[model samples]
Target: MSSPLKSLHFAVFPLPAQGHMVPMMDIARILAHRGATVTILTTPVNAKRFNSVIERAVEAKLKLQVVELQLRLAEVGLPEGCESLDMLSSTDPWFKLLGAFDMLEEPAEQVLRRLSPVPDCIISDNFIPWTSDVARRLSIPRLIFHGPGCFSILCMHIVTSTSVLDGIESDSELFVLPGLPDPIEVTKLQAFGQSKPNATKPQVSDNSEAKTKEKKGYIERVQEGEKAAHGILVNSFEELEPEYAHELAKAKDKKIWCIGPVSLFNKSDLDIAERGNKAAINEHDCLKWLEGREPGSVVYVCLGTLTHTSLEQIIELGLGLEMTDLPFIWCIRNKTEELERWFSESGFEERVGDRGLIIYGWVPQVLILSHRAIGGFLTHCGWNSTLEAVCAGVPMVTWPHFADQFFNEKFIIQVLKVGVRIGVEIPVVMGGEDTAETLVKKEEVKVAVECLMNGGDEGEERKKRAQELAEMAKTAMKDGGSSIRNTTSMIQDITEQLAINV
Candidate 1:
C-alpha cells in the first residue's frame, strides 16, 4: 500500500491589523517550510498586502498560498475594499454581526466546503469570534491566535466578558488582575477608553439612545461568540513571561502554546533575509541617512497606522525632537487636515532640517528598528512595535494610545525596565469627559527622548538591559531555541494528526 501522506493543510484567518497579519504570515511560512500546505484567508485589502509578502516569499522559494475573501455588504450598499472593523464601527452591533455572520462566517464556510482537498485545521484570529463556530461546523480543529502577550489576552478575557471593570470606581486605582505576580493598576487595563484610567466609554446623548441600545446588544453577541473558541495560540515566549502564561493556562481550559518572537525564526535563511529587505521604505533619497552615526545617537519615532495625533501634539513632538538635538526619523500619517500647513507655518521642518526626517504614510518599521543607528524608539507601545523594538535591542520612550497599548507600556517600563515612560502621571479621563485631564507637554517629551538618547546613569542601565533582552530574543529564535523548538513541535503534531486522518 502507498504510504499515507504526512503533510497537513492549514487555513489561517488573520485580522487586518499589520501586527496580526505579519505574524500570522510568518507562522504560515514556517509551516509551509516544514512541508505543510498552508492557505491564509484575509480581506481583499489585506490580501493585497499579503500578496506583496507572498510574492517575495515565492521568489525566496517558501511554499505557501493565500486566498482572498470578498466581504459582502451589498444589503447596506457599502463600497468594496472597506476595512472589516471600519465597516462595523458606526453600525449597530446587530448590523455588525451581519458581516461576521452573513459575510465572513458564511463565505468562509463556503470556501472550506469547496476546497479541492479540505483543510485539516483552521487557525483564526481571536477577534473574529464567529470563526470558531465555522470551524466547528466543518469539523476542523481550531486554533485562536491571540496576537498579543498571554497577559494581554488574559486581561482582555477578564475585561470583556466579566464585570471586573465595573467593580473599580471611576478615578480610583484598583489592582484589577489575578494572573500576574504584581497588581495591575486598574488604570493600565486595555478596554474601550480605559488606557487613560478615567477614560470611559463615550456616552450617547438623548437623541442617540436607540443607537446606544443597539450597540450594547451587539457587544453582547460578540462576547458570546468569543466564549466558544476551542484553543488559544499566544505569540509570546514562555521564558519571557512564565508566570503569566502559567496563570493563563490554569484559568483558561484551552491549550496554550508560547510560540513567538516569530520574526526571528529564520535569520540564517538567505531567502527569508531577502524577504525582510523588501519591507524597507525609501524616503528623502537617503537609505543610509544615519549610517556611521554614534552607536546610541538616533531616536526612531513611529506611531502605528491606527493612531492619529492632534496638531498640538504634533507640534509638541516636533519641538521635543528639536530640543533633544538627536538624529531622528519620524513616521507621521496625515489622516487629518491642517497637519501639513501647521508643520510648514510652525517652521518645525526648518528647525530640525538635517537633524530629522519625517515621512508620511506607512514606514519600514522593522528595518528601521533593526538598524544600528536606531538607538531608541519613541513608540505608541503597540504589541508588534514593542516586540520589534525588543528584538532590535532598541530602548523605548513609551507613549501609549488605545487598547492593549497601556498593558504593553507597563510591561516594557515596569516589568522589563528596558524603556522609560515619558510622562510621570498616567493620564486619566473619566467616561464622557469633554477634555483630556493630562496632556504630555513638549518639555516632558524632550526630556524623555534626551534621556534615552544620551546615556545618563539610568539611561546606561536601561541601555544595558535593552541589549540583554535583544540578545535573549535573538537566541530564542535560533536553531534549538525555544521558539523554533515550539514551532517544530507544533508542526510535528499537525503532521501526525493529518497522517491519521488521511
Candidate 2:
C-alpha cells in the first residue's frame, strides 16, 4: 500500500491565480500519486480555498499537503485579505502583483529551510522567479512550470527577442513567425501587443501612483529564472506542438519535459460532484436545455477572468452572439450591477429564451466543453481554456484579449487547424492593458460563428481535426504515450538529483 518513490519529495509554489493554481495542483496530484512527498507553498487565504480539494485527495490517501507561507498583501499596498489577483477590482495589476510576488521570497526561503524532511526539488511557476534563488541556496534543483504550450512560449520568445516586427509600421503588414513548423501570419497590431524582450520605458500612466521604481526591476527579471532552473516543465504533449517544443528547448537552453494535460490525471470525482450540487449555479437548466439539442450544435462562450470590455463592446458582443441564431452558453464576466442593463435593454434574454444561457459566475468549464452539445467554443484563448477545449474536441472561435492569448489563437488556427478567429479588426494593444479593444462588430462575430458551426467543408475539416487532436490528447496520457514516458523522465531526473543531494 506504500509508495516506493516516497524517498522523492517536492515543494510546489504556484502563482495565486485560478489558471496557474489548477494546472499546478494537477502536477502535485501526479507527483503524490507517484509516492513523492509534496508540500504546496501558498498564502493562507489562497491555501484555504484549495485545502478542501487537497483534504479530499489526502483522505483518498494521496501524499499531498498545503503549507501556507506568509504573504502580507498589506505590505504591498493591497487591501487586507486580498489573497488572489482575480479578487482585485482593478483592470491592470500586473506590476502590483509582481511586487507582492517578490515579497514572498523571504517567507518562502524560511519555510523551505525548516521543512523537516527537506524536499528533493522545488517546482514553481516561472512568475515566481525568486524561488529559483531559494532552491539554489538550499542545494536543490528547481524546475519551471509553464502553463502555456511550447508553441505560445516559443512564439513569444522569438517575437520579443528578435526583430520580427521591427520594420513594420502598418497594422496590416503580415509576417511569418520565425522558426515555427507552420507558416503563420500576424499583423503589426497583433505582434505589438506582446511584451517585447526589451520594453521601452513607459512615458507615464494615470495610475502611476500605484507603482514604485523597484517593481520595474522585477518586470525586467521575469525571464531570469529560466537561466537558473534545472529544466522546464510544460503542460503540453509533443504531438500537439512537437517542433515548437524542440525550438523552445533550443531557444532557452533548458531541458524540456512535456507531462500534461495534467488535469486529465485528476483523482477526484468527488470534487466535481460537490461543485455540481451548488444550488445557485442553475447548471441543471443548462443541462436540460442541452439535452434536446443535436450533438455538436451549441456554442460555449467564456472570455476568461481578467478580460474586461467596454459596455458598448458587451452589447455588441451580445448582439453578435444573438445574430448566430444557434444555441449558446456565454459566461459573462462583468460587474453584477451592469449585467442586467446589457441583457435587458437588448431584449437579449427574452429574444433567445431557453436557447441562450448567460452564466455570470463560476461554471464548470471543463465539464461544459466536453459536453456533447458543445460544438464550438467562443474563448479568450487563455492557455488553460485552450488546452481544455482541445482535449474536449470542441473547435474554438478565438477572440484573444491579452498576453499569450493572441499567440495561442495562432496556435489553434494556424498550427492545430481546429478553429477560426473573430477577425478582430485591430489588435488590442499590450494584452488589452493600456488600451481598450475596438468593438468587434456584430457582423464579424456572426460570420465566425457561422463558419465554425455551418457543417460546410471548412467547418467539417476543422471538426475532424479537432476530434483527431482529442484522440491524441487522450493517447498522450495513456501508458505508452510520449507524455507518460516524458513524465517518467521527469521523475527519474528529480529522483536521481534527490539521491545526489542525500
In angstroms, give how far residue 3 of model 2 lies from its true place: 6.4
Model 2 reaches what TM-score against the true structure?
0.91
> Model 2, 346: alpha-carbon shift in Å?
3.4
Q: Write the per-residue lDDT of candidate 2 for residues 157-241, one digit (tens) a residue.
A: 7876788877776666788887777887776556544323223222112235334455456655656777889999999999999
Model 1, residue 165: distance off in Å is 3.9
Candidate 1 wrong stretches, greater than 4 Å: 1-5, 73-79, 84-102, 160-167, 172-176, 188-228, 265-280, 283-286, 335-337, 424-435, 495-502
In terms of lDDT, model 2 sits at 0.76
- Clash statistics: count for each candidate: 3, 1
The residue-by-residue lDDT of candidate 1 on 1-502, one tens digit each, is 1111466788888876666777888788777766667888877777765566677667777557777777665554555555543233222222432344245777778888888678888888766667777876777677778767977767666665466666666543646565467677655334543433332332223226665675566556555555665556777787777787887877776667777787765453333333322333463243468674676688999876555455677777888888888889898765446887777787877878888877776666766677788889999787878988988888999987656777777788877888877863343222111124445778998988887777589888988888888888877776677766766666566566555655
User: Where in model 2 is the C-alpha error above 4 Å?
Assistant: 1-6, 170-172, 192-216, 267-285, 425-437
TM-scores, one per candidate: 0.86, 0.91
Cα lDDT, all candidates = 0.68, 0.76
In TM-score terms, candidate 1 sits at 0.86
